[model samples]
Target: MDILQYEFIRNALIAAILVSVTCGIIGTYVVIKRIVFIGGGISHAAFGGIGLGYLLGINPIIATIPFSILAALGIGTIGKKSEFGEDTAIGIVWAVGMALGVIFIALSPGYAPDLFSYLFGSILAVTSFDLIIMLILNVIIILTVILFHKEFLAISFDEEFSEVVGVPTKTMYLLLLCLVALSVVVLIRAVGVILVIALLTIPAAISRRFTHNIKNLMLLSIFIAIVLTITGLYLSYIFDLPSGATIVLILGIGFLLSSLFEYSIST
Candidate 1:
């Protein structure tokens, strides 16, 4: 109760809700499409944007947006058109992004005081500006999903069938990856680049155990993510743990518990 009085805690709570919405909606597609690896790759690739921001003296988060989108498009195109496997493409981009970030940061004139925050996340440090950015991104994600729900669903379930039906499978795939990029940006503040995929995938993965319906899966995932995020925030507050890592840990535990529960029912 007393914690609510603190501005930082309130901000963290708001950010958590926004993050949960983005993750729940976009994550369903990622899981059903089995593009979790692409999500991870995009998240890491955003690091290059972060480094570019430092080098150019701009907002790292802003920089991450464009950089991640380009990376997502590149990975999608290369994986689809090239001889290299998808995993191989992801690996190349992932390493290159991290290396670029490291080099850019090193070249920057001064030590990056907030570098750790971006890597590990500092939800407790979220300000009003950050909250506003997150809110806008969440709204955009929701509306986009609502507008293209059918196309996304068709493409996710069966790309070949979707193409047969004139669904523009390739375009939809790129659009879905773009959404993943947006979700990654939204999550960067809450869980950082390194752990964003866990938050993105865990909730959807856990929810899938209970429901095969996409709408239900998303709703359940939103509920689970909100619960775990708030619980993790509170736990981090009480124990002085890293907020992002704590949230991921709580989510991991939820995944294990959900898996066990499903197994028990099956047996």
Candidate 2:
């Protein structure tokens, strides 16, 4: 309660809520489409963007957006057109992106004092500007989901049927990957590139265990994510733990508990 008086805390809270919304919407699609690996690849690839921003002396998050989008598109194209397995494509891109980021940072002149922060996250470091960017991205994601809900639903359930019915499956898939790229950028501030995929997928994965309906899944995932994030923030403050890791730990525990509950019910 006393922490709320601080500006940084308030910004972190707002960021958490915004992130929850973005993740809830985008994560639902990622989970239903079984593209969790793609999300992971995009997140790691975002590191390349961060490193590029550092080398160019610009904002890392801004650099991450375009870099991640390109990585997402590349991954999608390679997976679809090449004879290689999708996982293999993702693995290659994942390694190359991380490697590129390292090379870029190494070539940069000065010491990257904040590099670790981007890798592990520092929610307390979020600024008003970061919050504003996150808010706008959240709105964009929400509106996109609302506008393309039917198309997304059709493609997620049956891409062949969706293409047969003239839903432009390829275009929709690419658009969804773009949405994921945006979501990765949004999450980088809160959880860092390394842990973004966990934050993106865990809540939605937990929610799916309880409901099959998309709307219900999104709503539940948002609720769970908000609770876990806030709780993790509080715990990190009290116990002096890493905020991002704390949040992920809480979500993982929730998943285990949910799994146990389901097991009991089935038994």
lDDT by residue (111-139, candidate 2, tens digit) is 89989879988888998888888888888
How does residue 99 of candidate 1 score in lDDT?
Answer: 91
- Candidate 1, overall lDDT? 0.92
TM-scores, one per candidate: 0.98, 0.97
After TM-score superposition, the amount by which residue 252's alpha carbon in candidate 1 deviates from its true location, in angstroms, is: 0.6
Per-residue lDDT value at 109 in model 1: 89
- Root-mean-square deviation of every model: 1.0, 1.1
Error of 2 at 247 (Å): 0.7
